[model samples]
Target: MAKTVNIEDAVSYFDTEVLHSGAWDEADDALRQKALNNAERILYRTYGKTYDIDDSSKWMPEEAVYEQALWMLRQDDAVQKTELGQVGVSVSGISVQMAGKPQYIAPEARRIIAEDGGSSPRSKWTVI
Candidate 1:
């Protein structure tokens, strides 16, 4: 999937501290683009293909959408870190405090998207 948000836009949406912490570094262009692509895919899958990334008026404001995109990007990063053994690693028999579960899209982001009038419609029904 093509990226819906660019790095500059994402940086604007995220905080300075966040960008500087290496959690979502602006210098990591490849990772940033990968995250944006992942985020776009998640949004497209969740909200359906009707979402027009080119049409700004069809969805939430740029900031809100980018915020969700950043969340998705961060989530992917966290998952990747976990998969690569970068997370929950400890040395010298010391315990390490781990971060929270990695989520594709946070509850707040969901609410924001939902409130923007996006819906996940079901085309098929199953009866038991």
Candidate 2:
């Protein structure tokens, strides 16, 4: 879990005050630690095979999906944009693959099968 402190009052980026927290620090470490401890405790709680979010038959309440989502969102890097540009994938000039002909024989019938050939008759048929 990410340790979220009151970074608003931070003096400097290299401030040791955040690392070696003191009593004068405005942020409440005890209250924050309590929540972290509770979260860790909740994660270790046992689960049953018959558990359901909607079912009212369980002993313990359903696990909070929103809390899990919040935890995942916080784990990702805050920086959406960066100075360096991303690289592109390397591929040879070009290559095309062909599909085999159909088994059934029909008069005046011709088909142009694409690389990603599909069996669905939606485009092949003109229904009235």
Candidate 3:
């Protein structure tokens, strides 16, 4: 699922960020690839309406997608949530309702996308 950003590019992008936790660095090739694909999918779902996903000229920011992948790796529950696509998960009587909408988005990714004018309206508007 090679989208706009590749693993090598993500690695180089994170290298310059002082706040990077090195989790992406520790992840194996398979995990990294999965994370990148998942991140891209999430972004496309979240902002696809606002941005031209198929148009390279208007491709979403690569940094935003990279930040999303890194953020997903940092979360202990991210993998389970994304993999299962579950609204809530209970383990050993501990129940956790997964965050919704904007909450699922990484902060840096959100900021980058917002700055790039990728903010999407919750509802569509049509002029008659």
**Candidate RMSDs in order:** 5.5, 22.7, 3.8
Give a tens-digit lDDT track for model 1, residues 32-119: 6776676666676666644666676554444444555556555544476765556575679985655765555656657767677766
Tell me the tens digit of each residue's lDDT in model 2 across 10-125.
Answer: 22321442353332244355543443334323322322232322344432221122122223223312211111222222349554332343222111111211111312222456
lDDT-better candidate, 1 vs 2: 1
After superposition, which runs of candidate 3 have C-alpha atoms over 4 Å from their true positions? 78-102, 124-128
TM-score, per-candidate, Cα-based = 0.54, 0.19, 0.74
Per-candidate local distance difference test: 0.59, 0.28, 0.80
Error of 2 at 107 (Å): 67
Q: After aligning candidate 1 to the native by TM-score, how far in Å is the CA of 25 from where it should be? A: 3.3
How many clashing pairs does model 1 include?
0
Can you rank all candidates by lDDT, best first? 3, 1, 2
> How far out, in Å, is residue 44 in model 1?
1.7
Better of 2 and 3 by TM-score: 3
- The per-candidate count of clashes, in order, stands at 0, 0, 0
Model 3 residue 51 distance off true place after TM-score fit, in angstroms:
1.5
Comparing 1 and 2 by TM-score, which wins?
1
Worst 10 residues of 2 by lDDT: 105-114
